[model samples]
Target chain A: MNYIEHTGKYFAMLKQIFRKPQKWIIFKESLFREMEDIGINSIGITAFISFFVGGVVVIQMALNLENPFIPRYLIGYATRMSLVLEFSPTLMSIILAGKVGSYITSSIGTMRVTEQIDALEVMGVNSLNYLVLPKIIASVVFYPLLVTLGIFLGIYGGMVAGVLTDLISMPDYITGLRTDLDPFHFTYSMIKTVVFAFVIATIPAYHGYYVHGGSLEVGRAGTKAVVWTSVVIIVLNYFLTQMLLS
Target chain B: MIEVKNIYKGFNGVEILKDVSAVFENGKTSLIIGQSGSGKTVFLKCLLGLFETEKGIISFDGRNYAELGIKVRRKLREEIGMVFQGSALYDSLTVEQNVMFPIKMFKNSSQKEMLIRVNEVLERVNLEKSNKKYPSELSGGMKKRVAIARAIVMNPKYLFCDEPNSGLDPQTSTLIDNLIHEITVENNITTIINSHDMNSVMEIGDKIILLKDGYKVWDGTKDEVFYTDNEAVTSFVYSSNLFKKVREVYTGNIKL
Candidate 1:
């Protein structure tokens, strides 16, 4: 399609989406499914990886401070900065691109190739509103929640390592976290996460909604949605942080 | 009733319909028949406003389709129902939900009323016990029936069927033809079907328009078609082996 044709379709989809936002039961269902599948269910894997990541960070810090020139409690400052600035938003987005992005792409692509979308058009139902809006809404609503949980668990992981490894006293670690953590960094992370969520949700939905061919094409679209969205999320995360914090 | 006047449509600089003008009357099954690539489907889509015609006017129920606003176009769509070449039922929805789709979109009926209407239409199409089944589970014929049930559930004033019997067995095709014809007559709907099937043409052809190379070559009733001297019509009518065998039988050239 040419630019004009593509723009026309885009506007038509937007108009349809806004026409009847209330009649979005299917979107709500898909959103709930995305949250459960992407956010809630992936918590275990996120926790495990974050625990090891924290352990690695603390061990490296302890070894570097072996000369006793640097304060041992500064490990908490380093952990807090890394988790708030990069790890939470970036890793959570990667996980969600795999989990929720794949689901949205596959489901919408199947609907497109199966003539279900055409059926909606013939019935005067807007396929975009029925298919894409829910995913967009779900991503915007749940991605921040996931990022928040990731940050908390990530910090807790570092605390467990610091206390169990006896590298730093428990009181020292607690006081370090309280003093080093900046509320502004947490806010910035959340803002970046929301932007990443928009990119992750919209890109996959766009690719899937326009998909043609049969099952093979749907599979290709699902893979493409995940790969492209993850790349965009990482690239955009850098720019968003620089723009917001610099 | 629907009227198409001097409509010209083309894709990629190749004309599919050139100056095509025809009238589809109410309470009759109007068929547009032609060989493959004869632009019957394109013309039907043009009539339905799915494609914009390059030139000319299409009026549905006396409203100029080209001049109507989006709201009016949507209102017109509400009174129109289409059964696509494929059954086009939503795979995720049950049979009952498929039939209830249009009603939900354009009607203000209560759940009780909607269910009653859905069951009535399903029973009308002889698909009573299959309400909860998905489209994947239904046979081809059953799926078509469900599509028909969905099309008519809203009591649309206009019905369009594109090759309604295309992929069915001969017996099932006849059954579908008879059902479409019966429904058209009973409801007084303006139905326009696009097909090249001679069986369907002869079975329910209240008004048949034959197209050849983007031009309407013949327009008449089924019985009237037998007496035409047009060579294209004669060749098409006699091309079937059954008609050829019947011709031989009448001429005493075969021992029947």
Candidate 2:
């Protein structure tokens, strides 16, 4: 489909998901299941990557500031900026775009192919609301929490790297985390994750919900959902950064 | 009764249903039957309101679907129970949960009351013991039974089944067919089944509409199927050599 048509349908799907659920109990159950699937399960990977990547960023910073005149604390400062400003939110969200986004797409897409969605419609259930809303709500609630975790872990990772390398003293690393910390950077990160969370939830759902054909198409939808979600996240990240930070 | 008048449906201007009309009488198992690509599934989807027709007015008990407000439409839809080709059970839910799903959605019954009704339906379909098992664990026949149990759990006024016996063995297919017919008669529901399964057609098709490439070529009962000279109907109904020979014997054109 063309961009205009895709955009129109995406908005149409967005509208479909906001209605009151036919069964509040069912919706509540589904929502909790999604939180477990998208959030709780995601904790391990996000934490692991955030820590290791954060340490690697600090090491890279140390290597780059090879000049003897440069202050040791700059490693901590640069790691702080990277962790809070970009790495935690953007990189982790891209990872989620792969992990959570594909799950939403493949599951919904399989339902479409299997006539499970049709069963919902025939029974007067709003398939989109029943299927997509929980994931959207879950991602919205959880992405920020994950991003917060990512931020704390990233800085801690940086601190670990700094102290172990003996390039910066432990006190200096702690001082670096405290020094000139603008609360707005976190505000900026939260806002970006919220937008990307919306992106991650809805875009994959759109791909999956409209998918035609069989199992092959469902797999295709998963790949397409990831690609589109990541693209939207990157693009939205730039805009949110420009609009919020600038 | 469900009446669809001059239904016209198409996808992207290419017609799949061409001004077809039919009545599905209450307390009877009416069927839409045709070869593949003859739009049987599309016709069923149109009847189920899963697909919107470009031109048609389908009514249930004199109430027009198009004219019903959202709340009313939903009310009508809630009265509909569908057995999809794949049975369409939520893989995540156990048999009992699947059966309980619709009653939980439409009624305000307590869990005990709902479980009683769920057990009743599961017992009717002979699936009471499979309550805790998930859809993944059931055989094709068991899954279809579970699908049937789920469909009728709400005691819907209308029931739609798309290819209820498509993948079952002959014995299981007959069992599914008999169960559907029995439920339809017992509940007095306006049941419409879409099938290319000839065994189902011969056994339980109370009213049958034959579609040929989007057009309703014939509408009649199974007995009429034996006598009709309409080549489309005869060719389709007696496509098998055994059935053709039986038809010849019935018409006295061949010796016993």
TM-scores of the models, in the order given = 0.86, 0.98
- Winning candidate number (lDDT): 2
Cand. 2: chain B TM-score: 0.98
Cα lDDT tens digits, model 2, B42-152, are: 988888888888998999999998888978887899899999999999988999998888888788999999999999999999987999999999999999999999999
DockQ of each: 0.44, 0.82
CAPRI quality level assigned to candidate 1 from its DockQ score:
acceptable
Top candidate by DockQ: 2
Q: Give the per-residue Cα lDDT of candidate 1 at A109.
A: 86
Give all candidate RMSDs, comma-separated. 3.5, 1.2
Runs off by more than 4 Å, candidate 2: B252-256
> TM-score of chain A for candidate 1?
0.86
Q: Which of the numbered candidates is closest to the native, going by highest TM-score? A: 2
**Cα lDDT tens digits for candidate 1, A31-60:** 786667656776777777767776677667
Lowest lDDT 10-residue stretch of candidate 1 chain B: B243-252
Error of 1 at B29 (Å): 1.5
Candidate 1 segments whose C-alpha is farther than 4 A from its true place = A1-16, A20-68, A72-76, A157-176, B229-231, B234-239, B246-256
